[model samples]
Target: MTSRRDLLATLGTVSLAGFAGCSALPFGDGQDEKSDDVALPAATVEPISWPESPFPVAVPSTLAETHRDRARELLTAVPVDPAVPNSAVAEELQSDRERAADRLETDTQEPWPTQELSRWRDRRHAAATVRGTYRAATGEDDAEAVTERRRAVRDELSAFVSAHEYRASSPLEAVLVHAPIEELVSDCRRRTRPGSGYPADPVADPFQAGDAVGLVEFADATLADARGLRDAYLADRSNTSAQWVPLSDTSEQLQIALAHTRSTVQDFLEHDEPPFDADLDGTAGRWLFTEASRRVETMAEEHDVYRDDGDYARAILVAGRTLAAIEALRTTIDGINGDAYRDEVTVESVTRTAERAREALAAIDASESPELAAQLCRPALDTVELLPEVIEEGYADAGRVQGELAWAELYARAVPAATAFVSERLG
Candidate 1:
């Protein structure tokens, strides 16, 4: 295992090599001018050599078994919004097509895949085709037609893969381990798209990657470099030049607060989450939800955050994901109130986090959020910074780090504060 110092030194080398060797990664999205890793040369990103015809030519592994009929289940499950006029559906779809056109027009402006990834290039084109088909399809497509359409799409992609002669990578499994952590989570949350690499699929590997779907394909060397970068980020929070990860939340803060209350009222539930009665109802539903939540919490708490020279870089990546969810709260709140009626600390904290989150989201290819998320996580991230020293120094250190601790405690308070603020204003 490389020591912390050794890892950082190695990362410095890999970053230099990556920039000198290929297109820059799609991170930060020009948000941080200081990130030297995102820039690339003008030789044009050429397609890499592909592998022999034995490529996995079926549906995605997880989707293969169920997709023949189950592929459209997600779309089928969506209930038409009764409030939306049937007359307007076509117009809305037209607008969507126009937006997609706009996206393609700007795709070149976004970060091109830095690695020699044939799939990335191939997937982009396929995604366009699928988007076009879906947009053009009338709701009248019969079940048989839908199934055939799904098969045709799969065949087209499989043909694309088979034609390529892969060299450096196995086209079957692509696991991205690098890129900013917030960006990672954003990629995971992206709705499954035809060419989006089955990002919502569970990563089959052993890396404790959380809701991070198998999107963003990082080269082996790049992940190695990321390990060092994450470690450096954990320790170097106070540096003025440091690039604090920008995580963006597009969730509406008022809506989030309102939704929680509405849910409670509708259910006549007192708790934000109804205490699961596992004994009374042996359903695995809550168990699964609890496990998922536990996975996220454990990732944050057990991450190498508290080490004096902590070094579990992958876990920290997961921690970044947890932070993104927390930060999303604040991002949704941004611009709605413009810090109105919010304290300086709370405003400043979320504002700072929102900026970082947005930058991260854009870098990771998020098409903005549905609503802004909570912005009260900055103080917690900062407080978490001191947790290591407190553990090491015990009671003496606790007093010295009281400010950070207090801020962490108050970080949770943002929930109630925001709820009250929105409820009061709405009332």
Candidate 2:
């Protein structure tokens, strides 16, 4: 293995190579007189590739049969609330089952096939039985009933996790299988206080379906993941005789790479012409920078948590993913134009964009012929009216909110002719 110093030196070379293609472009939107003279630094991006698929492993035919039988037994026995005739959790489970039904079909790769498909199909049928018992659980007046059912379901889930330890042949394989399961269990353990004053609901309704169907789906996925991990571990173990690299070495390299990328993004925003004008202009650019920064910070936080828990393998996997996200952000940043479409997708940004659209609408309403103005800008006005709902109910992430803002701005700008006409009449 290369020393950390040597690895970083190699990364620096790659960063400089990436920058070579970008340095010649003129900085800014032709707004600054000295923009043409500004020199651009190379983006400190490292080349991080995803793990290769562990295929062509020898799988025992009986493995699938055992999995299918186990899935049917577990799912058929899941409990539900006695009183709630119609649960929102049931609707959610049916939807999830339908969405996952397609995974039942086997892919081109084979050898250990039929059992996985059977397991999925059996789980789907079991879901029908689950949705039937939870009616009326979604109503506001039934919050107590929903919480009661949730607690019951959570108790079962906690027991399941505690009783089963899904292990694999290798550390990396073990990390992949256990991480998602542990994360789910941790969420289940959190105490939900009614007036906790958190940003949003810690989990979805009924805690993202603390119901029979949801529990079965979770069990099936966990088992499937464990199966896949076992296969991969066996394959890798057969193919490679070398020992795994030291965790400290990889961790140090990731730390240096993250710092480098963070600094590069900061440098661009600070020194580039047109500035970091997220409020009025370059919204996408600002958002890209903000998200990239957030991801870098998150990677560091994840690393700390994993290390403290002595899960070095999981930390390494997270670092790889973080690098990939940073690389993608850098690519998007390179493509940014002088537009607000990609601005930081926050509640504030959403509200601001909606206000700008409202101002445009007011101008049209105050025109010499209000009726004609409405006729001319009907589509724009319709889109602007929908903004209040978006403002009231925030989005899942920065990307989604950013896209909404961008489209809203696009629709607002589409009515340039109507706005111009209104201004002309008023003048």
- Any runs in candidate 2 off by more than 4 Å, and if so which? 1-224, 239-245, 266-275, 278-294, 327-427
RMSD of 2: 21.4
lDDT by residue (80-119, candidate 2, tens digit) is 3233334565555455434323322323122123323334
How many pairs of residues in model 1 come into backbone collision?
27
TM-score of 1: 0.23
lDDT of 2 at 346: 47
In order, candidate lDDTs are 0.27, 0.39
C-alpha RMSD between model 1 and the true structure: 23.7
Task: Encode model 1's per-residue lDDT on 1-427: one tens digit a residue.
Answer: 1121222232442342132211111122232222222222211111112111111121122222222122233223322321223445435434433432333233221111222122222223222323323322332223333334434544543443243221112111101112232232222223223443221211221111211111221111122222332333333333322111211111132224433433332321223342443221122122122222332344345433322222222233333334432333233223112422122222233334333323332232211211111221322332333233223322111111222222233233333333234223222
Model 2 worst lDDT run, 10 consecutive residues: 42-51
